[model samples]
Structure formats: C-alpha cells, structure tokens
Target: MQTHAQIDGFDPERIERDVRRWLERAVIGFNLCPFAKAVYAKHQVRIVVSDASTERALLEQLGEEMALLRDTPADEIDTTLLVHPQVLGDFLDYNDFLDDADALLEALELDGVLQVASFHPHYQFAGTEPDDAENLTNRAPFPILHLLREDSVDRAVAAYPEPDAIIERNIATVRGLGVDGWNKLLGD
Candidate 1:
C-alpha cells in the first residue's frame, strides 16, 4: 500500500537531525517536504497532502495551485503516512502534556502495523509560547486523543496502517468545529 509522510519546513537540517536521532521511534518512513513555505494567503502552513479522494483531474488542479501558491518542496524520500499534529481545543493543555514523549508513545496502541513517533520541534522563541520558547518537541499529549477508542486501532490498521482512521477521525472532529467544512479540502 502506498502512503505519504508529509511534513512542513521549519529548518530542513534540524528536521533531518531530529528525525535521524529518533529514527528508532518512528513507525513509518516519511515523504518530507523539504522547503515548506508558509501559506501567506491562509494562516495555515501550505503542504502537498494527498489522500484517496485526490486523483486525476483534482490532483492536476492541486498541482497547479501548489505551484502558484506558496508551498514547500517534497523532501523526505521513501516514506508514506503523514505525521502531523492533532488539533486540540486548548493550546495550554497541549503544551503542558509534551513533557512525556515516551509515556505518550507508549500509550499508543501500536502493534506491528500501528506506529507513534515524532521529532523535537523548533519554536519561534516568542515568550508568549509559555513553554521554554526554544525547545525541540513533538507537542505530544492532548485530551482530544483521550476521546479515541483503543479498539479504533484495529479498524485504522485495516484502512491505512500508518495514519489510519485515527488521524482522519481527529481531522473530522476539528473540521466539525468550523462552519466551512473539511469536505471542501479533504473531500466528501
């Protein structure tokens, strides 16, 4: 099965360093986007994400837009399954729980197929960040993950072993918080 491991650029060398340092922890290889450009038009970081729904014509259109829009180039080689942050309602709670990467990863229901892993993050060094302001981290824990049923792991593995249903469920959840709809981007 083909999977994509999409990541944004903060610092390419640092990202590679962290990924290498934590290679033992990663569940799957990543298709890292080496030069991620901040989406100036939109608040979110623009990435070349792909899914089952993105095919043929739509894919072509997105390819064109990605060229026109600010974007990062594909970087990591030989990796599938997107590794990303799970959106949480509260940022403080999210920051507070990052202290225990091992505990957090241990909590995941990874078997042979399931995987949980991430690298240390590079911050902008703003005092308002509340944390160290300059620490490498995965920003691991959040109560939103607590909502997931452990049994969901099996279903997720059956679907997409790397990211699986778990990530999709979370994405649906955050999108639900907005009036616009994830369907516009992710598809129906």
Candidate 2:
C-alpha cells in the first residue's frame, strides 16, 4: 500500500512510531480498550499513516483500507488504524468527517462486516467540556480512523464480563488519572 509520505511531506515512519507509542502506552497500558491488547500483542494491528490533506482523499483511502481489512484474514490483520495527521486536524471537522466515513462504509457494502471508530487529539464528547478528563479515553496522538471487524467485536464483547461497563470504567480510569497524569502516562 502507498504510504503517501511524499505527497504531504510527512515522515510516515515517524508518524507510525508516534502512533505505536500511543497505542502501546495510552491505549494498551491503560487498558482503554480491553480488546486492543490481545490483537496488538499478536501483531494483528495495522497502522497506516496517510498523507491525504483533504477530506475527499482521506475518504478514498478509508474505503481502500476497509476493503483490505475485510479481505484479509483475522489472524493476519484483526484491525487497522488509519492515522491521517494532515486532514481534519480540527476536532469539529474531524467529527463531521465521521458521518462521511460511515456513509462510505454503507457505500462499500461493508457496513455489517466492518465498522469505524474515531480517535483524535482533541476528542470531546457532545456533553463534555474540551478539558473533560473522560475525553482522554478517546484521545490519541493524531486523528485516527480505527477499523475493526464486527465479528471480532462481538466475540470480544461476549467473552468479557460486563462489557457495558467498559465505558464508565474507562471514564473513571482517566478521570482518576486527570490531565497531568494522563500526559505523564503518554510521556507527552
């Protein structure tokens, strides 16, 4: 697959490194997503650094990534993180783009097979303030379109006890950590 590093003057390797650190330290270390640790440890997570500077370009890349994930076996690639640092830097813009991301999933007829989850540096929920500690749960090093297999999600949720409590547990975890603690954890 094309890294598109030359297109936007972004160093894909560096971007991938930063993302990996975030995934390992913030996501896995903190247990934000219980399902993440196993797939990551198994080397089934694919991180793609996109150089797309426009929403259109990024959307196109998203479609391709979704198809690739659908076609690939679960053992080889359980999930993908498409990190697009150039486009949708603003959280508002990034939030709006998620609708289009979902639409693209329907268009590709992969709606039931795959799903998209969002993570951004400034990810604020609808009711929460920008500085709310809970938002940290979804925050990442950059704007990320996390693609996953629906069947995998089902299996994980089924295996984990009280799967519905994960969100509240995550919020409490980050709230306890607070902003400074969170930054320290991420080595920011």
Candidate 3:
C-alpha cells in the first residue's frame, strides 16, 4: 500500500491526528455513537489511512481491510476506520462509492458478517441541506469507511436501551449544538 506521502505528499501522521481528534471530540465527546467508546477505549478500533487516488484502488484497499477485519478477532480489532483522504474527497462521489463498497463485501462473502458505515467531511443525508445540523452526526475530518461486525452491532443494540432513538436523539443533540457549537467542539 502506498503511503499518503507517496500518493499526495500529505503527512499520514497529521491525517491520523486529525481523525483521532474528530473521533475524540466529535464522536465520543458528543456521544454520537454510544458503541464507539467501548471499543475505542479498549484499543480495538483500527485506524487505517489509505493513499489511493482512484476509486478502483480505494476499493482494492477496502477489500483488503475488510478481509483483515474478518480474519482478526473482535477483541483484538472490533472495527476499522479506513480513511481515504485522497480518493472520493467529494461528498457525492464518496456517497456513490458506498454501493461499490457494499458490493465488494458481498463479492467477498462478508455481507452477513460485516457492514460498512460511511462518514465524510461533508456528509449529508437525503433531503437535508449541506449545512444542516443533522449532517454533523456523520461528519468527520476526512472520508472514512467504517467497517463493523454485524454481531457486535446486534450485541450493542440489544444491550443499549431504546436503540431506536439513537438517530432521533443524535439529530436533536446536534441541532441543539448548532453550527457554531459544532465547529467549536471540533476545534475547526
């Protein structure tokens, strides 16, 4: 795999730092994903910075990351954040690439075992405007393909109270935060 420096002359360390900051400040700090803190605190979340500049190359790396996660134990690596800063930088392109990502999971016979969640710097939901507060729930420092285990998700949902309210609660939470608060929390 090519390093970010080799592909775009960007510092991988700084990219990772930014991702970690987003995870800590926005995701964990805001309680955006209740399941995230446990795995992250356990050091079971794998953060990979991909250097692919093309969709095909990024897909190849995604496949490899999926396979690795499949082979690895959940205790050792429960989830993976594949941050591809080079390719699919555009939100629409990144949104479209999710289909290909899922198809790759099916092709690899990992559809039932694992799933992909997406987070981009400018993630927007259907019918939501670009600057909508709800979008902040999915925003990150860069484009990240979050690979998760279905069993883990099921366990988390079963353990948590009112799992169905997560989305609604997140929307309300971000709306309460407002754009300025969100920016301040993320140190943007």
* For model 3, the run of ten residues with the poorest summed lDDT: 3-12
TM-score per model over all chains: 0.19, 0.94, 0.95
lDDT of each: 0.28, 0.93, 0.93
Write candidate 3's Cα lDDT for 76-179 as tens digits.
Answer: 99999999998898999998999999999999999999999999989999999999999999998889999999999999999999999999999999999998
Q: How many clashes show up per model?
A: 10, 0, 0
**Candidate 2 residue-wise lDDT, 1-188, digit = tens:** 55556565688888898899889987898888999999999999999998788999999999999989989999999999999999999999999999999999999999899999999999999999999999999999889999999999999999999999999999999999999998887774
lDDT of 1: 0.28
Off by over 4 Å in 1: 1-90, 101-152, 159-188
Q: What tens digits encode model 1's per-residue C-alpha lDDT throughout 84-113?
A: 232222445334433332243344322232
TM-score of 2: 0.94
**Model 2 lDDT at residue 120:** 97
